[model samples]
Target chain A: GAGVSQSPRYKVAKRGQDVALRCDPISGHVSLFWYQQALGQGPEFLTYFQNEAQLDKSGLPSDRFFAERPEGSVSTLKIQRTQQEDSAVYLCASSFDRSSYEQYFGPGTRLTVT
Target chain B: AQSVTQLDSHVSVSEGTPVLLRCNYSSSYSPSLFWYVQHPNKGLQLLLKYTSAATLVKGINGFEAEFKKSETSFHLTKPSAHMSDAAEYFCVVRGPYSGGYNKLIFGAGTRLAVHP
Candidate 1:
């Protein structure tokens, strides 16, 4: 029984650098969500996917953020021209069916922009 | 617009004492409420959820919450506080999604501290 997995538990990048965070959802999970959590704050939604289609991305902060799930099972969140305010923990979650509301989360990738 | 409000930013209790974490929500319609916990350096773990099945929902670790439509409240409570119970708790509300998708709206969160 495997849960969601995120790559590079921790990453440090320069303010203007580009960074990519990867997420592997549970096998066969049809729903995937990405969120950003700042220090001492609750997680805010970033984007979501159903299979290979990008369903919603209204939560992405700005144009610097981009996400893709081309294969339907794995998703990636990329930040270009990263800024200091972009530092936070990126979380990924997956659920068995789109109809089911419960979501299981991964450990998350902590990104620090210096 | 749907949002959750955790009344207290932090709650401290002595071991063996009762624990209470308050949450209030606002939604256009009946919403599914959830409680999630996160330990230090760990990911979020679901404690329980209210999916309109029952007004009073029971969760893991002997915790429970009663949904009050009148008060718009879903406060979490436990019989007693344990050291292991100290963690950050988030109150979440599930939002209706398009194309049969479901999304969660999260609260700011409440930090719990247990002292022996």
Candidate 2:
């Protein structure tokens, strides 16, 4: 009955620092997605995974953004050389199947780069 | 490419009055539309979805939206506004994903303010 959960609800990082955001998808969920929400703006897609496979990373803003889900249940989004532009709310969502449109979201981790 | 547009950036309504949040979408194929609500410092919650089922879809908290293919609109509406209804509302469209998965494209969102 638990929903998707993310760790470190808030994170502050210095410029050029590397930060990692974690997401724990709902148990048995086959699809996981990450999104970025800038202030006063809508969320933008970042990446997606099906099981342990990183199927889509086209939405990732830059090469510095890397994501992995080795075990297929917990996924992490790592940003290398963090920049001020990287500041935003990182959101994680999971769905029952790949095609299912209904996604449950986590509270999100707000990252601030200074 | 599929995209969604939330016409209004903000809407204010008095308690017990009607509420309307307009949304229009563009897609190459049949679209799956959804409405999500976000409270401050909280996760997004699903209000309702239109997956090519009924034209009018009802969601949680007495909210509903009518899917109109001709107008390319899926506008959310409620007969009465409650104090708790104040929040940010998003209209999302699912992009065509050939890999058995679809990407969600969200509108800028509409901020709803309820007044007493």
Compare the candidates by DockQ and give the number of the best one. 2
On residues A1-114, what C-alpha lDDT tens digit does candidate 1 reach at each position? 888999989999999999999999999999999999999899999998999999899999999999999999999999999999999999999999989899999999999999
Best model number under lDDT: 2
DockQ (CA atoms), all models: 0.82, 0.88
State the C-alpha lDDT per candidate: 0.95, 0.96
Indicate the residue-level lDDT of B60 in model 1.
99
